[model samples]
Target: MGDAATPLADTRRWLERAVIGLNLCPFAKSVHVKGQVHYALSEAQDAQEVLEDFTRELEALVALPAPERDTTLLVIPRGMEDFLGFNDLVARAERIVRKRRLEGVIQVASFHPRFVFAGEAEDDVTNYSNRAPYPTLHLLREESMDRAVAAFPDAAAIYEVNMETLRRLGLEGWTALDVGPHA
Candidate 1:
């Protein structure tokens, strides 16, 4: 989906063409339109450095008000290419959230190029729902999430609906979007 030189550009396109365009995350479009999404690129060369960067970004998000920064996408364009390693990093990130006593205040959601759900096959089209052009940590405010969920009816079915959408889109349609790791 993106090379080292243009992770932010690629990420923005994925947000526009896939996440928002396909309605993968129903709440994304509003914040995006408001310019409340923060995109940060980290050049950390290892897991520890990535965690440090994550901590900084986490603090940064909390330091700001919700109207100014509703969410953050910490894009790691280096040293986190392996999905398993990236998954481990995500665990560490959650620990940081707890360590800072922000468990309910903020939450971490992960996305990776090779994101595979539990029991799902590596090539399953469903995995694409969480797949992104790069390893990313999505930091969200719990209050904002709660409000959004409250406003959207049948929010519990978003995942099932996304699966149906992707199933209909198929591999060719996803390829047409050109937003996956291989794009």
Candidate 2:
């Protein structure tokens, strides 16, 4: 998080070792291999700046077809480190999506260094699935998502499957991947 490239490097590693390697995101590998994933590290120091930058990225995604740019990783290297604040920022981000009339066309997914599920304990291993090297706003295309889900067998079970995978990996195994916390 300190260096300029740290976020991207850590993020790429997380994708490689955790997301893709563990098969957490079945669709990620294909886009990644095709060089369609856009990773943009934002240098914004506050939420406002991050929001502006996020809007720009969202627009950028809209400009390109799904094949050229499937999704975007707007990684904020600063601000919103606290999960509560980060969650609030995510809400604002969604508002922007709706404001831009991209509600059904684009959606925002969240990833944070300290992501936690509503009912899960802070140390729950399941949260690691949403943890990223930095606070990232994942801008996804609705149509692409629908296509991916339609093709994925039992798409509704992804969450349950991911939870089970993390449960088996445990805290030690997650730490071994060097992606995030053990607690």
lDDT of 2 by residue, 57-126 (tens): 9999999998999999998877878999999899999999999999999989999988999998999999
lDDT of each: 0.92, 0.90
Query: Candidate 2 at residue 1, lDDT?
Result: 33
| Stretches > 4 Å off in candidate 1 | 1-5, 181-183
Residue 112 CA error for candidate 1 (Å)?
0.5
Task: For candidate 2, give the lDDT of residue 174.
Answer: 90
Determine which window of 10 residues in candidate 2 has minimal summed lDDT.
174-183
- Candidate 1 lDDT over 1-183, as tens digits, reads 356548887888899999999999999999999999999989888999999999999999999999999999999977898999998999999999999999999999999988998998998899999998989999999999999999999899999999999999988998899885443
- Candidate 2, which segments miss by more than 4 Å at Cα? 180-183
Clashing pairs in 1: 1-181
